[model samples]
Target: MSPTIFYGQTGKFTFRMLATVLGGQSICILLGALVARAIAATDQGSGSSTAYLVVGVGLGALCIVAAGLMRRPWGVTLGWVVQALTLLSALVVPMMFVVGLFFLALWVTCLVKGAKVDAEMARREAAAGGSEAGADDDGTADRVDG
Candidate 1:
């Protein structure tokens, strides 16, 4: 099995890792908005305040949507867009520069490491004589003959 083929399998580690990052980011965006409001940068009852909240909500929603889409190939592309938006949020909230960097690092790490692991899994599966089962973490392959 190729890495791409293996990655498409349900309940893979890469999917879990990337999904976690995006899910966590949704919460962070909301908190960041609250922080901006608390700092008085978003004037009370003003359009800027509402806009900030709206943007936060939108980004949070987008994160969830992206997470759901991760089973598809383009889902990863959507995640990249999320990262870009998070970094751009620094324009409104300076703290986002730090938050964005943290998440971005996680995203990249997960992609790189997860791909390697998946490719390893694919290699192992191939070596397992075309067994229906994938390799386990303990360097063993489960036999699942139909």
Candidate 2:
């Protein structure tokens, strides 16, 4: 796939990576809720199960929208909102705090590293383009016998 469409502008690699991560988080949350319902300790009732399902589905939807929006400037802000919601989920499942924190760290790292990679790629592309332009301007192209 074209990098511009899949990953957004040259300097926004972090946004693309963040979108993928959010999608993953959505699936995990849905699966975890179902698993928790299966476990005896957490088998509350149909009412609780429904609640879990609703939250999971809502989160999944949000992740999908956020992923698609990553190309926009507001995408990062939406990502932060998703992160906060994930952290807030700990109120329902205490263990989620740990999981949420881990993902939070991963999110931060992806943003930092992805931004650096984007910058490096942009720099290389600019250098290459400049060199090609100079060669054409200097009559290097015409000098080639072929």
Candidate 3:
């Protein structure tokens, strides 16, 4: 059996990593929400705290789906949406403002660096292709000894 290769553009990898981070963050948010609910229970109730749970879980699921959708053109757009939602989460959990900012920085870095890496990879592939074509036309092997 042949081993499957998962090679692709660097941007995809970056987005996948972002998705993973978002999913993990979602779980953290859920835990925080539960704690918030317990605290609020002594005073008010779970009514407001439930919003955090719902939004947290929902964002987590969205991130997972967005990761899969990275192959599509709209995948990046979805990522932006996730970022916005993550920032908006600060409204509920004040600490999320800090966490969200950190993630936002990471997301931006990924996009910028991913594009650079992808461009370099494409350039290298094109050069390799050109070299291969020249060798074939000259009836020579494309490898060198020593």
| Cα distance off (Å), candidate 3, residue 115 | 0.3
**How many residue pairs collide in each prediction?**
0, 0, 0
Candidate number of the best lDDT? 1
Predictions: Cα RMSD each? 6.8, 6.2, 8.3
Tens digit per residue, CA lDDT, model 2, 1-146? 33222223425667778888888887766766665445534555444666676776787688788878878867767777877888887777677677778778777777778877887988988988877854676537546576
lDDT to native, each model: 0.80, 0.71, 0.66
Q: Return the TM-score for each candidate structure.
A: 0.76, 0.76, 0.72
Worst 10 residues of 1 by lDDT: 2-11
Q: Give the C-alpha lDDT of model 1.
A: 0.80
lDDT of 2 at 128: 80
What residue pairs clash in candidate 2, if any at all? Answer: none
After superposition, the stretches of candidate 3 with alpha carbons farther than 4 Å from their true spots are: 1-28, 35-39, 134-146
